[model samples]
Target chain A: MTDLSYTSPRSGSRTANILLRWALYIMLGLFALFYLMPLFVMVITSFKSLDEIRTGDLISLPREVTFDAWRTAWSGACTGIQCEGVRPFFWNSVLIAIPAVLISTLIGALNGYVVAQWRFKGANLFFALMLFGCFIPFQVVLLPMARMLGLMGMAGTIPGLIFVHVIYGLGFTTLFFRNYYVSIPSELTKAAKVDGAGFFRIFWSIFLPLSLPIIVVTVIWQFTQIWNDFLFGVSFSQAGTQPVTVALNNIVNSTTGVKAYNVDMAAAIIAALPTLFVYVVAGKYFVRGLTAGSVKG
Target chain B: MTKWLEEHMPKLVLAPSFIVVLIFVYGFIAWTAWVSLTRSRLLPRYEIDGFIQYDRLFASPRWDTAFTNLFVFGFLFIVIAMILGLILAILLDQNIRTEGAIRTIYLYPMALSMIVTGTAWKWILNPGLGLEATVRGWGFEDFTFNWLVDPDMAIYTVVIAAIWQSSGFVMALFLAGLRSVDQEIIKAAQVDGIPTWRVYTAIIIPAMAPIFLSAFIVLSHLAIKSFDLVIALTGGGPGYATDLPATYMYTMAFSRGDIGQAASSAMIMMMVVFTIVVPYLYSELRTKDD
Candidate 1:
């Protein structure tokens, strides 16, 4: 590459600095608009009644701001004889997502702690295998997974779904925790060991408290992943046991019915709200967690 | 015995996950690959029927369209996402006000499921209901922004939506890299009379090469496996103009009940990803370990 270093002859002037400042602002302002456009439309459309939305003027202020669409989307919208909207599935999602995050993160912490701290024989081998498995597309594994679940009599059940999510999440979750743990000085674990703290004991006491950042990251990642998962929920869930994403997908993604753009947008936003909330609130930790060892070996 | 037990307790704890992965994840993947070689449909069968499945997969026009579309979508998505991400990172590095808020705004979309983002983008791009109608209503009836409906342009619509959804993630990754750049080097460059843009292009960009590579890999992986966006947005519509390998494999298995062909297509998709990623992985392992 040519040396791109430029020697400036012009002095830093009062007018030039101000222009540069405003230019930066204008550029970012435009970018923010681009980012916010789809979301703005979704939020507005969610507040509009179906009649107003049919006018198809997406940019105009809704002639009527009715809570009816939100109500119907959440409660009365039709999804296969359960005219009840997103409530049941929402709760199911919570029920499933909470346990999945907790169990998976716990296991992940253990995996990370062991892999980083212990240097056991073939430990890297195990980690590599798990990582390779992660790269295989989930669609390829669907049928055999379903078959295995069926054989185990756990297919379409919460435990089965939980197992699926944990297994799938194991790679990234382990990667996150391992990288985070590696960053912590070994002296902590070593000192705990000198005090005769058992492996799990040191992890629980010495390491766990220091892991709040990664815990938040893991919780956010696993929560969003398990919560918003469509393929797994659709594949493994029966009607009564489905997550909100499935219900939302059925309602919003149905091919043949007169598609309600407003409800569809609302449902989409609703499906994403919990995860989005976590991102906005704890985005710092999330970004930090992802970036810890971003330049991977 | 006690010493041995002490030495092995940690690995023993790791056993459950390893076993779970083997039996459930990898075992299932292997099983699926095996099924691709057999003549099964809608469900797995033990009967081996030669290379018949692979032959059918090769013969299908849908498969060809899907492969081509993936390359087109993948190339556009990766290139555009990288440019947009790098630019956003550079701009954000200019000591902007409300750093935290802007970071949150940019990174927020990655938090949403592709399904939701796809749906929202679909509405925003709809010719009858969205931008076209709104623009024409502002008195330009001659305006032609109907890409969403145009069969030739539908995949590009997907590219637009995908860029909107993912460039923020790339921005976040690049920003992290930019922040880690040594401030002293930048100060030295300024003292030497190097322009700000040149400083970035020459010093910062090369310094951030590893992060860039990692981000490129991550985004490429995402682009290759893109399914939720396609499913939600166009449903690979306008007679398969936007069809991709992942979505094509899905429809083949579920809708068409061609398990053999679906598996073959799935195998090919996996091969494509593995070919790109494995070489990258090998190089990383070899060079980084040293």
Candidate 2:
């Protein structure tokens, strides 16, 4: 072929490749924009004054970028006679979430260790039973759980809600640690056994240290689940012991009044900030934990 | 081991948790199932009702809508989440810059509860407040994004919001699977001058089958019990377009004061979940057995 013709063909293919690349970029950009639109609206609405929210376009720049909504959502919004924002429930949420995380993950790690290392006869059965429990909707068990809590005299308290969180969280947390433990080499546990380490000792010193990755995951997962849990928090407890989700819900989920979009958005975002903060900070380990959890032993 | 246990410690160390789960979780489940079979209403009454509750539940139009909506919501959620997840996964796996930041952005929604995130999305999707107004303000006088208001389209809005919350986890799963792929395979494809897309489509995707299955199972389970998103989004409204089984069960038990029928609805949902979960368990066990 002539040199000029060869160059022409090469340039034509280069142009085609450039066109394809631009098309792909545009498509992906559009998808990302659509994915982010909801978040964009939430952030913008949170910044706008309530009057601006009423009068201006949702996409428009806020005439006044005020922290008033944030302040109100956090401190002044009222669900009932009390005008406290979700402030009280914030402490209640933290109280429930911390213990819920600690106890659940500790037990989960132990359960995972036992199931993965020492397969007792009914161990698989136990795991299977727990796994099945995960599928039962909370609605199915809510009444029974409530009745049981009432019988135990722990109803409508932080401890009662914590118990509910632990019960519901057992499945996922066990699965997380169980799967992670299975990924670990059995030889390590066997070596610990040979060194005269009993179950508790080996777990405390070796298994526990090695399980930082999965533990972080379990903690993060349980923290977020318990922190933001609404059904258990709302149903298991009275108004006084309700978590931030319920408090946030009462602020935004009002049925009889004209809904305040800006306040609602701010409140929702406020409720989510703790979990979102964890995700932003320790999100790396969380992602690692998720991948590790998904991998089959 | 049995003989050793008999000689030393008879009860296992894990017995406490096992019993807790059995009595509280499993035992309560049995109790609830029993309640479904009885004439319970407004509260748990221990009197047998035969199949009366089930019959009534099957006959109710609201129940029918709830069941239909679940199937529609479940199918659409799984499909869209898988597709979008795959696309994001593939993109992230392409040696992209700022991987950590992008990964965080994607997975943050999964960490928050559906009530919180769903409420946010509901506001953003609301016609009067969110997208519709936003589009109209952008020099589009006739812009009509009314899915939030339309009875038929409202559920799709929920699906859209749910997909946003879940597909990130799916992407993370695929990314993990991608990371585990043998580096030699990609090198071999490069040596053979195969295009990157062809290589990913032909070779890597097939190898990521197990991860895909795992993601599908998790997403499907979430879709089935997806009550909070429905509740916070539309409250199953514009006339019950987004009513799911779990939310329906809630309304039946609490709002309508039909505890038996609600329990029956929960039972049916259990059966549906069993159909999905039993096979998943079986396949997982079989794979382990092999």
Candidate 3:
């Protein structure tokens, strides 16, 4: 490449470089449209009236924009026996995701601290078992979990769902924190231990302060996961207790009435908004968390 | 007493989660395996009855369709997502001006739940209301893109949505891999007059083989566990034409009240996952230790 550049006059190579750059840009722009088209359709349809949506092509900008579908999707769209819409289910998701994220992150942090700092007998084995939890298909646990929920008398409830999320979430959360903490110097903990610091003391004073970045990653990952979950949301909870994902499914797939395409689109967007907001706000951290969680742990 | 307590606090702090995983993950697995061997129904009955459930599971037509669909969906989803992701990553690696914005657009779909993807695509694929109608409206008069309702092609609709949702994630992984390649080596290759495409094919791509493997492992597991996407898009319909194993297991367990069959199917799904995962885990852990 260098020889060619040196041998050739600068003008011809510059032209070739400009042509290549334009070609790359055009290709990327086309692919970008492919990725954005569904989202464009989703948003455009959501703001149209049902009649307008019916008459218009899928790709057309709405003739008239209205918030009617959004209003109905938020407050009045029927999901089975309930006419109250996805509002309650939205709150249900919030209730479930918050506690689950906090508990999972907290436990993950402590577990990561102990495993990374203490290095007890069988620590690696315990960590491995916990890590294995990350890959087990939720199907493998459904029957027994149902039974366990029944025996515990928490079946079909939000707390039961939280319990399930935390338990399942422990794997990735622990992995994130463990991997993060492992990169912290063991000498810090050693010094703390030498200063008459016990495990909790050293962790709280020393490790916890340094854990903010990982905590953010774990919280965001767990929140997005639990928020977007449908299998557990549908399986573990009944109609009244279902999460936003399940309720959105019920609304969109409900076959008894005239299919409200606009309302369905609105509901879908509503369901996706939280995670979208998180991504837009802290995209860097989210990508970092995703890659770190994926490639390493 | 204090020393003893301090000495034991780590274990004590770790005990709850350990116990939870032990029960919720491992113990439940054992329980599900046992239930598969039993004659459980809408309500679990603890009478251990041999391989009746497995035999029934093997004999069920629905299970067969579900398994076949899993193969098609899993294979197509993984391969297409990997290739597309690699291409997108390579394109982005050209250091184009809009790389960040383009990358973000590609990745945003991953943040949305599968249900959302399904619902959005369901609208776009709806024959009467979506692309078919719109295309026909454009004066073609005979344009039809109705795969969503076509029983034979319904499963591929799922593949489309799944790939759309995940390929960006694969691209991100590959982009990270691409960026980490030693630039000095690339410069040396360039100095030798190796073409840019040849540099990628001969040097960069081969060096990123581990990223490819990791992406494959991730995407395969995701494909196997796909449920919500199918549920939202097709609901395993035009009459169970698109049932993946995960959705099939859900139907048997919850809707059909056939816990025995559900357990058997679930066990089979786990075995599929284990076959892929265990070897990966073993190799990964061994390599880490070394």
Candidate 4:
């Protein structure tokens, strides 16, 4: 609360200063309104009836809010092949996100520990190679990966998507843990080493215990990334295996009759719910993960 | 045996991921490079035919539009987002009481998937029933906001949506950069009767150049890889008006079954990424203590 940089504006009278501060508050509030507009529109539209949507203003509260559209979006909205809503795809995303986050986080913690604490030739180079994975355009690997997935007999399946996510996600996850672990002094590992602790022993006893914060950050990052992914989901999965985002896209984009605006908005909010939930619940850690992933140590 | 095991264990644990990166990341890049040079079709042929695919890719008009859209989209999206983000960041750094609440509202868009963003913006920008209609109802009888369906202006609509999604992230980065500024130096400037705006222009903003570059790299990378948003927003619509290289490459490989063009376009995208990223990696790795 006590920011040392706090200073009032000079060169203005008392009334002028008051006016300036009010202007600043109004500007911030207006920007906030701009940022919140799409969300506000989405929520209001999602709760309206089709008649209300057609007959009323684009941005207003529903005449009488209805759960019918949400229910349809969750269970009856149609993609090309079926009208089964987002249930199957939502579960598909859940299946993909949980295991991918866990396995990637596990590998990242170990990889990060060794890269940060243990010294060896080619370690940083290896780490650099892995880190560069985060930056490669996923398009470059699409053809080869598609072929490879087919060759391995995992194409068009959930496991295939998980493998793809974990492979691609390793760079960010490892970077997260490695950055966190580097701040941990090597003396702890050495002190344990003198007491005859082996590599796995020291990591298990020491590093893993100290990794709670980064683990929370990494899990949130990976979960959000994997859950909200659309390109990989659309490219790699078949009809039933599609993630919620892809399913939602199909439902919205494949309209044949009168367009269901309410259903479309409701479907979007549903598809966006998981990451939105994670962000709301643990946003501080989420921001930390994003800033950490980009800003160099 | 125990001593030997202890010494090699770190490498042992890291072997699987290192090997995966070597094959899946580096090895596949090599494979894609070969495919780009081949006369591949539905199935990839292993033989190289010396950039025939690249020739075809450059020849295609869709690829040309996608390529041009990349620049138009990237330049507008990055510049506007930076200006807005920097403005908001500077404002928020004034020790405002509502900084946390405002930052959360601004940055929440970054958490939602691009597809979700596309859906929301698509609806709002729709001509028949969206902003145009809403304004018309309010008695501006001749207002028209039809950019969503207009091929010429569709790409700008994407730029607007893209800016909304990421400008707040740029704000977050800049806010962090602003907070790390030396309080003592700012106080010293204030003591010299340096006006607040002058202090920011001369000292604070210029010092945040690295953060600006960081934001630039992030924004450009997102702009380059943008697919989901465009697909959900415009579907490369009216014609092939809004295709970025990513969507164009997808259409080639999957929709049209021209793996050759897809592979070739992929190589160019990779090259663009390498150009931006290689120098960054070199500088970052060189300066690190490890």
**TM of each candidate vs. truth:** 0.94, 0.91, 0.97, 0.98
The digit string of per-residue lDDT tens for model 1 on B1-290 reads 97787668888988998998887777777877888889898777878778888888778887878888899999999999999999988888776767678877787788788878778888888787788878887889987787877888999988998899889889988887888888778777777877777788889999998887888777778888888788778878878888999888888777888777778887888888788778777776567347
**Model 2: which docking level applies?**
acceptable
Superposed model 1: Cα runs more than 4 Å off: A1-12, A187-191, A255-258, A292-294, B1-4, B47-50, B286-288
Supply the DockQ value of model 1.
0.53
Q: Alpha-carbon error at B185 in model 1, in Å?
A: 2.6
In Å, residue B48's CA in model 2 sits off its true spot by 2.6
TM-score of the first chain in candidate 2 relative to the native first chain: 0.89
Question: Considering only N, C-alpha and C atoms within 3 Å, which residue pairs clash in candidate 2?
Answer: none
Candidate 2 per-residue C-alpha lDDT over A133-219 given as tens digits, one digit per residue, 9 for 90 to 100: 766667778768878999999999999988888877888788888887887788987898788776777778977888887888888
Model 1 alpha-carbon miss at residue A117, Å? 1.0
Candidate number with greatest DockQ: 4
lDDT winner between 1 and 3, please give it: 3
Candidate 3 whole-model C-alpha lDDT, 0 to 1: 0.90
Cand. 4 TM to true fold:
0.98
Query: Residue B172, candidate 4: how far off, in angstroms?
Result: 0.5
**Fnat per candidate:** 0.54, 0.46, 0.71, 0.68
Q: Candidate 2 — number of clashing residue pairs?
A: 0
Give me the runs in candidate 2 sitting further than 4 Å from their true place. Answer: A1-28, A183-191, A256-258, A292-295, B1-12, B186-197
lDDT sort, best first: 4, 3, 1, 2
Report lDDT per candidate. Answer: 0.80, 0.78, 0.90, 0.91
What would the TM-score be for candidate 2 when compared with the true structure? 0.91
